[model samples]
Target: MKDFKFVSKTQETLKIALINFALLLIFVELGSLGWYFVKHKQFFYTREKTQNKSDLGINLEGVRLNQSIVERFHPFFGFIQQPSADFRPGFKVNNYGFISPYDYPFKKNKKNQFIIGIFGGSVASDYSIFQIQNKILPQYLKQLPGLQDKEFVILSFATGGYKQPQQLLILNYFLALGQELDMVVNIDGFNEVALSNLNNKNQINLAMPSIQHILPLTSLANNSLSTKAMQTTLRIQENKTKINQGLESLQHCSFAACDALTSVYVQNLVNNYRKDVVAFEKERGQNQQDDEGSVIYINKNKSVLEDSAAFEQMAWNWAKSSIFMHKVLSASNVPYFQVLQPNQYYQTKRVFGEAEKRIAFNNETPYAKAVELGYPALLSKLPNLQKNNINILNGVNVFDKTKDAVYVDSCCHYNKAGEVVFSNYVGSSILESLRKDEARSKKK
Candidate 1:
C-alpha cells in the first residue's frame, strides 16, 4: 500500500510539471504577439517594396551605383564595363564591355568608317556610348554639312570618377587590343581638379585606387543589406503613422496611457533599428581607417599647409601625361585632341541659373577652392601643351560671354543644351583638325 501511494504521488508531480510548462509556453506566445501588435499596430503587415538589383544601372571603374550587375573584374583599372547590362531602359552595354548598343569587332563592310574614341570622366559617361553615337555628337555633326553620309563609330571609354591616368589606361587597353581608332578626344577637368584637392591630404595620386580597394569599409553585400534596412525603417515609420491616425479616430476606452505607451514603444523600436544602422556605418568607417594603406591618408598636423604646391605638381603631372599621350597617338598615326573642359567653380561670371547657382556655390564642397588654386596652375601649363604640338581646346572661358546657363550642376556636368553647345565646339574642332591632317597628307 505504501509503494502504491508513492507511485501515485510521482504521477501527481509529473502532471503539475506538465501543466506549468504549457502555461509558460502560452504566456511566451502571448508576449510575442503583444510586442508585435505594439510595434506594428496592425494584425497583419505587408513587406515594403524594394528595387531589384538589376534595376540599378551600370557604373564603371571608381564610380559606384546603388544597384549593379557587375560581372567582370579588371586587374589594372578596377572593374570592366558590364556587358549587356540592361538595368535601365535605353541603356545597353555592348559585347565588348563598352557602354554601346552595337556589337564590337566593327563590321568592316564600310571602308570609310570614321571611328573615334572619346574618353573622359562623368561628363563623357553621362548616359552611354550609344547616347553619344546616336544623340549627342551626331546631333551636332548632322548639322555640319558634308558629315551626313560618313559611317561613324564613336567608342566611349569614359567612366564616372575616373581621372587622367585612368582615361589613358583605357585608351592604351583598346589600342593594345588591336582596336582601330582614327581619332581620340578627351574631355575632362572637374575630376582631375576635384580628386587632386580631395586626395592631396591622403598623399595619393589624383586618380583613386580600385572601387573595392578604395571603399573597403563596406562590401557590396553589406551595402545592399544597409539599403534594405533603411527601406524597412521607412516602412516601420509609415506603419507607426498609420497607427497614430487610427488611434485618433477611435471613440475610446480611456486609451490615453495606452496610446502614449504604443507611440513610445514604436518609436523605441524605430530608434533601436536605427542604432543598428549607425553601428554598421561606424564599423565600415573603422574598416576604412584600418585600410588606409590602400587609401593613403597621411594626417599632417597642418594648421596651415597650403595646397598650392600640390596643385602645381598635380597639374604638371597632368601636362606630362598629356604630352605622353600626344606622342603615343602621333606614333600610332592617330589624331588626338584634348579639351580642357570648364568647371562652374572658376566661372566668376553669372553663367549659372538659380539651380546651377546653388550647386556651384555650395560651400559644403571643397571644389571651389580647389578650382581657384588648381585652374591657374593648369592654365600655366597651356604654353607647354602648345609647345609640345599637342592639339588642345581650352574650354575654360567657353561660356564667359554666353547669357544662357551652360553648366547644369556645380560639378560642371552639362545639360542637353549645354551638351549641344559643347559638342558643336568639339565637332568643329575635330573637323578643323581632320582637314589639317588631310592637307598635310596631300603635301606629303
Candidate 2:
C-alpha cells in the first residue's frame, strides 16, 4: 500500500511538470508570433508608401549598385543577354545597356581624348556634397586649359568601407571590361586597417550574400521605431513647455522641471552614442576571423591606447597593400595615382595641439608614413618601367591641408570648399602629367 501511494505521487508530479512545460512553450510561441506580426505590419505599411514614390532603384546604403550590376553581368554569371533597359540615369534604352560607367557618354569632343578613372572609398564617391562640386578630380580636369577640348570622363565608383584588396579587385574588373583609361586614381587609407583587422576572409565571403546584404533592413526597421519614439517624446515635452509658458503662476516651477528633463535627455543621448560605439567594437571583435577558420581573438589584455604597436602594424599593413596596388596598376600599364584624404583631426583647430597629435600617433596615420617612405615601396617596379619609358604620378600630397577643410566636427571627407580646392589641385596635377607625357612621346 505504501509503495502504491509513492508511485502514484511520482506519476502525478511528472504529469504536472509536463503540463507546465507545454504551457510555457505555448506562451513563448505566441509572444514571438505577436512580435513578428507587428514587425511585418510596420514594414508593409512603410514600403507601400515608398512604392508610390520615385524608386531610388538600387541600395545606396552601401556601395553603388552600378558596380554590382556590372559584376552580375560578367561572363561568369552566364547571363549574356542584353538588359531590357538602361538602368543608369541619362541613358536611353538599348540592347547593349550594360556597358561600364567608364564607357558612359561625355560631351561630343573635337579631337584629343583622355579618360581618368577615380577610385577610392566614400571620399571618392562624393556622397555628402552636390554632384557638380562633390568630386574634385573630374570637374577640375575639365577646367584645365589644354584639356578643355579633350574628351575627359572621370569614372568614380568608390564606396565607403572598401579595403585595398577590394580596390585592387575593382581595378582588375574595370581593366577586364576593356576600359582604356588614361589614368586610374586610387584614393584610400581610412578603411584599410579597420577592415583588415575587423573582417576576415569568411566574413568577407558572407558579406556579399544577396539575403545577408539585406541585413541593413533590420537596422532600418529598428531606426524607424527609434525615430518614432523620439518624435513622440519631443512632442509631449513641447506640449508641456507650451502649457507651462501659458500658466503664469506655474511658469517658474515648470521651467525648472523642463530644464532638468532636457538635461537628462541630452545626457541620455551622449550615453547612447558611447554605448553604440562600444557595441560596434564588440560586434566587430566577435565577428573577426583568423587564417585557420577561427574567430580572431581581440586582445582584452590591453586597451586601445596600450596596444600602440598593433595599431601601427595595422596601418603599416594597409600602406603595404596600397603600395602593392600601385605596383599592380603600374605593371598592367595602367595609369594610377594615390589621393590622400585627410581625417577630421588632421584639419581641425578644435582637435589641434598635443591631444589630437597623441590620438593620431596612437591610430598610426598611413599617409604621414607613406610620405616618409617617399614612393619606393609604391614604385618598386618603376625602375624597369623607366627603361620602357613609362612613368606613374603620385597625387598623395595634393590635399594634405594644415588646417581643417571639412565641416566642423566632421572628419576625413571634405566640404564643398575643401572639395573645390582638392579637385583643383588634382585636376592641375593630372593635366600637367598628361602634358609631360605628350611632350616625352613627341620627343621620342
Winning model by TM-score:
1
Evaluated at residue 322, the lDDT of candidate 2 is 53
With candidate 2 superimposed using the best TM-score fit, by how many Å does residue 203's alpha carbon deviate from the native? 12
- For candidate 1, the 10 contiguous residues with the lowest summed lDDT are 54-63
Q: Estimate each model's TM-score.
A: 0.63, 0.45
Question: lDDT tens digits, residues 1-444, model 2?
Answer: 999999999999999999999897667555544543454343221233232111211112221222321112222221222343433353222232223342333332535767666666666665312233344555556665565666655555454445555566666665676655666776655555333333332133211211111222222333322343344334434433443232322222223333234334443443343334333323323321222332321123222322244345445454555566567667766666655554443332333445434333434333343323323333343343344433334434444553543332222555455566666766677667766767877899
- Residue 192, model 2: Cα distance from true site in angstroms: 1.9
lDDT of 1 at 401: 65
What TM-score, to 2 decimals, does candidate 1 have?
0.63
Which residue pairs collide, candidate 1?
Answer: none
**Best-matching candidate per lDDT:** 1
